[model samples]
Target: MAWVYLIIAGIFEIGWAIALKYTEGFSRPWPTVFFGVSMTLSVWMLALALKTIPVGTGYAIWTGIGAAGTAILGMILFGESHDGWRLFSIALIVIGIVALKISSS
Candidate 1:
């Protein structure tokens, strides 16, 4: 259950991050609202997960998911770099996230 919350939180972290680009510095009304909602949910879910998960492990995994996911979305959605090294870096982050989960268990 806690893991589920953490995963959801991480996903929302990615959602808010991607939505940030669309927010256009908070000038866009709809995207700004979406960003705010996603951010709130992300934090709330993190809090729930933290009730059981260690802070260090939980936080690192959450941010790792967010960072890797946002980077992938940036490349796919916004024409950001898709270089081999960049992809490899993202894969490493994912590997770290998986390792953390396994260690925590």
Candidate 2:
């Protein structure tokens, strides 16, 4: 289904985002390659999902997944932050994503 592709694409977006951080400004070979590949796949999947889903709603949900996942992973894996406000903001993004999905259906 299109929703499945969208979710997978969003997860790949998180992967590419983290891989980009490891790329060291494209200086590193493997991480850079990973980022490139992941980014391509993510975009490809997003486009595929867009064939069925409304652009505005689908894109918003995709970004919401990527942003929230990236922030949470940054805190857990990269040492970005554990701030309450940051967590709250991520929660809000999640809530918004859910609301959008519910409204779309």
**lDDT of every predicted structure (CA atoms):** 0.98, 0.96
Let me know the TM-score candidate 2 reaches against the reference structure.
Answer: 0.98
Q: Estimate each model's TM-score.
A: 0.99, 0.98
lDDT for each residue of candidate 1 in 1-105, tens digit (9 for 90 to 100): 999999999999999999999999999999999999999999999999999999999999999989999999999999999999999999999999999999999
Top lDDT model:
1
Where model 2 places Cα greater than 4 Å from the true spot, the runs are: none
Q: Estimate, for each residue in 8-39, the C-alpha lDDT of model 2 and write its tens digit.
A: 99999999999999999999999999999999
